[model samples]
Target: MKGWRAFLLRRLAGTAAVVLLLSIGVFGLLYLAPGSVQQTLLGIRPATAETIAAVQARYHLNDPVAVQYLRWLGGVLRGDLGTSIRTGVPVADMLGLRLPLTLALTGYGTLLAALAGVPLGVLGALRRGRAADRLVVTAGVVGLSAPPFAVGLLLLVVFALGLGWFPVYGAGEGLADQAWHLTLPAAALAVGAVGMLVRFSRAALVRELEQDYVVFARARGLAGPVVLGYALRNSLVPILTAAGLIVTGMLAGTVLVEVTFALPGLGSLLVESVTFKDVPVVQALALLLTLLIAAVNLLVDVGYSLVDPRVRLGGGPS
Candidate 1:
């Protein structure tokens, strides 16, 4: 716990700097996008001078790019993310409502991935060349190869259409209802993550099992299960890293899952914002996603420290 705490504190400064730099990059990208924000928002290729002037005055479009970016960055630092160019609503307020829904979907999918993938991977590694192990490995490969949309559609057909278990569309009404509805999308998102975890976990376990420690444990007359447990514990750092990457992918918004299920999430919000040229929303979401990915990576690093003493005590950012 002490080392984990220390590692987190060590990472905080670096994480903040990365987020700040990424926010700048995102802001600049959106700023350089084709046509002026006024033109896009107003749906006019050539907007009137008076109208453009009004917008420039209201949003400070006439300000220097650095000034504009600093102004937005200042607002972000002050608990504001600016108003949406399309909705005229505060971008933060819009995200505040939708963020949790996206989080729920991501959490659900991640939970599913961890629960199924980790155990199946361990089982496959333990079994090695057995039929069940082969099946598990093949299943994981297929899951990885298939696209999320295609996997989602196939799941929709089998569970939502054939068996009629889960909702076919929408996130549904209440929490319980939403959980039921989110199952298919969650499964779709989980497919690729599960594959990655299975592959990583099995490989990590196999490598750990081959280490001298495991052989020593066996020579000391430890039970097979005890040695396996020891290896599994030691293998967790790599597994956690893979899991963190999965969550990063999830936070980036599982675009197809949200789109296919008609779920309101940051991913879909991002798509809609881009389509409507909601520059503020787009910039805010992009920045938020970047920070989230950074945070996840930070946590994964902290996880390494927790799992391995070398990382916690002496390893620095390796």
Candidate 2:
């Protein structure tokens, strides 16, 4: 128990350190980006000297970048994310309303990816060198090759415009309606993830099936299905890792998907915030997304222990 407790504490400390660095990097990039907030607010035309000076004074734009970063960091530490210059709303409030929407979109898409990927992977692994295996492999390769936006655009054209099946855009008015609207965007996000998962899962399982234990099980007259199940259980750690990575990637990739679908999610907000140079909004969103990715990694690590008892998160051997 003490070892596990120590292990968790160490893991948490590492996560906190990484998050701090991530926030610093993200904040640093914002300052380095072209155009000041005032410039974005002012549009294409250049502002007069006096107007620029006034704008800087109003928003503390003239403060040293390090000082500004410290001030913002201090506010964040105090649960005050500062107000959005663009919308005149508290950044935290804006995120509160939008974060859940983004999470739902990403989560649902990941669910679809896993459901589609895992079984197909298992099937291909079991039927290696056959037509089914070739087809699955081909699909995965195509998915990996295509960008998510292209997939989103193509799906929009075919399923939304051509087939007239799912809606082209928007988050929709109600739960059922939103689910319907999310279908294509979710599918687009899931495509690459599903493909990668299938390929990884197939390879992991095939590797496991070739192990002496698997052969011994077969020699001992174990049913094929039972042996397959055993191989699957053993293969899960790597598969889980792959799924976690896909989920993390989905968070970053959501911007294009959300833009394509017109969902009022954080990805869209981040894009808009960047475009308008909404420093508070952009900073807060980056920190939040980084935290989410960290959380996912932690969860996957815990999942590893659950899927395989020989592995322990408390600095023990696999």
Candidate 3:
């Protein structure tokens, strides 16, 4: 218990430090970006000193860079992420509305990836030398090599234009309708994920099956399915770790997919903010994403111990 607590404390401290560093770097880039906020907003440069002062005061840009950073950091700590310069809406409110859509897409896509990848991996490993294995390998290679936007375009061409099976763009009439619209985009995002998962799971399972315990299980009259299950389950720790890492990638991937499909998710909002140079919105979204990724990774680390007794007992690197 003491060791676990210490490990968790260390992890939390590390995460906090990383978050601070990331915020600083993001803020610095925002400050150093070409053109001033007033110039971006007003179209014409502010010639009068009073006008420049007013602009700086309005945006809190008058403060020293370090002071501005401190204030922004403090606001974040207090859950007050400031307002968007372009829209005059609170960043938190905008994020609250958009985050769910992104989460929904990511959740469904992850499920699809797991459902398609795990069985394919297991079957391919079990039928190592067969035609089916070769087919699965070929599919995985294609998936890994193809870019996501290309996949999205191909799916749109086939399903929307060629077959009229799905909509070409825009979310549906309602949430359920939106899900229906999401099928192709989610599948496109899942393609690479499924390929990676299959490759990792197959390799891990193969390696685990060669261990002494697996040999003992085989000697103990365990059937093929039983042996496979044992091996796969034992290999799940690394798979879970990979899944956590994929969540971060999925968040970034949603940017392109959302833009392609015109989904009102955080990614689309982020792109708009960037184009408009909405610093507060950009900063808030970046910090929120960082915190979310950190939290997910922490949960995955904890889950590793829960899933494997050896992990808990060994107390080695997770």
Which whole-number lDDT from 0 to 100 does residue 209 have in model 1?
Answer: 87
lDDT of 2 by residue, 1-318 (tens): 877789778877987797788778877888888977888766766799988888789889999988988999999989999999888899989999998888888988899999999999999999999999999999988888888899999999999999999988888878899889888888899999999999889999999999999999999999999999999999999999999999999999899999988889999999999888798898899889878998899899889889999987878665
Best prediction by TM-score:
2
Ranking by lDDT: 2, 1, 3
| Model 1 local distance difference test score | 0.85
lDDT of each model, Cα atoms only?
0.85, 0.90, 0.84
lDDT for residue 297 in candidate 1, whole number 0-100: 86
Where's the lowest-lDDT run of ten residues in candidate 2?
37-46
* TM-score-superior candidate, 2 or 3: 2
lDDT of the structure predicted as candidate 2: 0.90
Which candidate number maximizes lDDT? Answer: 2
Cα lDDT of model 1 by residue, 1-318, tens digit: 676567666677777787788778877877777767777656745587888888889888899989988898898889888999888899989998888888899999999999999999999999888998899899889878878888899998999899998888887889899899888898899999899999999999989988999999999999999999899999998999899989998776377788888888888898898777676788788777877787788778767878876674334643
Stretches of model 1 off by over 4 angstroms after superposition: 1-10, 44-47, 219-221, 313-318
Candidate 3 to truth, TM: 0.91
- Which is the better candidate, 1 or 3, if ranked by TM-score? 3
Local lDDT at 264 for model 1: 88
